[model samples]
Target: MASQEKIKLVLLACGSFNPITNMHLRMFELARDHLEDTGRYKVVKGIISPVGDGYKKKGLVEACHRLEMARLATESSEWITVDDWESQQPEWVETAKVVRHHHAEVLSSENNSNGDDVDTGKYRKRRKMEKKSPSCMNPKADRPHLNLLCGADVLESFGVPNLWKPEDIEEIVGRYGVTCITRCGSDAEKFINQSDVLYKHRKNISVVREWVTNEISATHVRRALRRGQSVRYLLPDSVVRYIQDHSLYSAESEQKNAGVILAPLQRYSKTE
Candidate 1:
């Protein structure tokens, strides 16, 4: 029997990433393991997209810092990378829009890599030259699919009043699909059953249960930093150094942004 072809997919984790933590990086591995275990999907890449400053969430640091910290955290990961597009936006963009943009980006990259644009119009000539080459496979066969990666809290947040739009949810879950990593208390199944949209497109959603409980929360990390406590093991050493060098999340930093109105979006929470 011939080996089954897997769907090429990229996992996109969008969050505030106020300070990328160990658990944040682990989520990608957990999701990849679960997806590959099924032998149906191949996770070729993982992207961390930090929310822009326009999100207005309390304790949320500057986009530059968040983006750089995310980069520093994922530096050692071969397939994991940080994208600053979302954080570079002038305003808070919806999750669905972010997903759509990235999907297009992946497709564009795949096209370029597949020799679709070889020398502008010389693709035909190149194809003719390599007509007998076994490596010249159809690009569509390996077209990359982008999926939103999130915690169960984000799946449940679909029900939060006015926090997320219904159409956006449909586009995200229905179109690009979602890989929700289950947290201890988050009932991902219950939330899916409660929402008609999610239930309608349930097949596209993959609920990945994280067996090893990692309770590393950026919120708590911030609190520890503010209180001058140790957050060594909770976050990456480079990220910790970056935070210390920049004085981020300190009591003084908190005081400077004291008037920042906390939005319903919880920072570094399970939702992120």
Candidate 2:
């Protein structure tokens, strides 16, 4: 009798990660723990893909900065890696496409390892087989299963009107699946029950309830920085230093004209 092959799992976390916080990193651990608790998957890699500048959200900062911050944040973690592919894109690419692109890259690399070109149609068929199989079993056992890791806030937003396309939602949930870490007051079950699409694909969504919640957000961090308050424990020390050194999120950052006004003062002032 042959032994069962262990299934490989990789998590892709897509977000702004303007200044990657401890909570952002925690989501990966929470999801990995939840999935490993099932005794069905062995999580190999965790990828943090920051959103492109094309998102155009206020206070988003630049993609280069965000990517560097993410890299710095996760440098100590062996399992986690930062992928700049999405950030390097010329324009904003949808989340679904990002997932597909990562999956394709993984598949292409795996195929190259075997010295063969990947066939898109055949890969899709293989994915379908893998998805249908039991947790501990896979027909094509070698391929790694890529899942989207996010917070419950992101999960709830999926149901928001005009936020995401119907097809993209279907592809994300139906194909890659999601592992959402529950935030305080965000009912993952209730959100699923309320939405027909979510309810239908509930099997693919794993809701990991967090007992002790960390309410630290980038917005809050930025606000604290702008007010000249201590964000010491909110962000990593290295990131904190980076922000201070770069003068990011400060009141001066918001005031474009401040440089001109302060140029003369800076020349005369000892604190300059």
For candidate 1, the TM-score is: 0.86
- Ten residues in a row with the worst lDDT in model 1? 130-139
Q: Please count the clashing residue pairs in each candidate, in the order shown.
A: 0, 0
CA-only RMSD, every prediction:
7.0, 9.7
Candidate 1 on 27-132: residue-level lDDT in tens? Answer: 9999999988887778899999999888887677899999989989988999999999989988788888898788767866877888686456565554454334
lDDT (Cα) of model 1: 0.82
Off by over 4 Å in 2: 1-4, 114-140, 252-272
Identify the runs in model 1 with alpha carbons over 4 angstroms from their true place.
Answer: 1-4, 118-142, 255-272
Top lDDT prediction, candidate number = 1
Clashing pairs in 2: none
Per-residue CA lDDT of model 2 for 152-179, tens digit only, reads 8899988655556778888888777888
Best TM-score goes to which candidate? 1
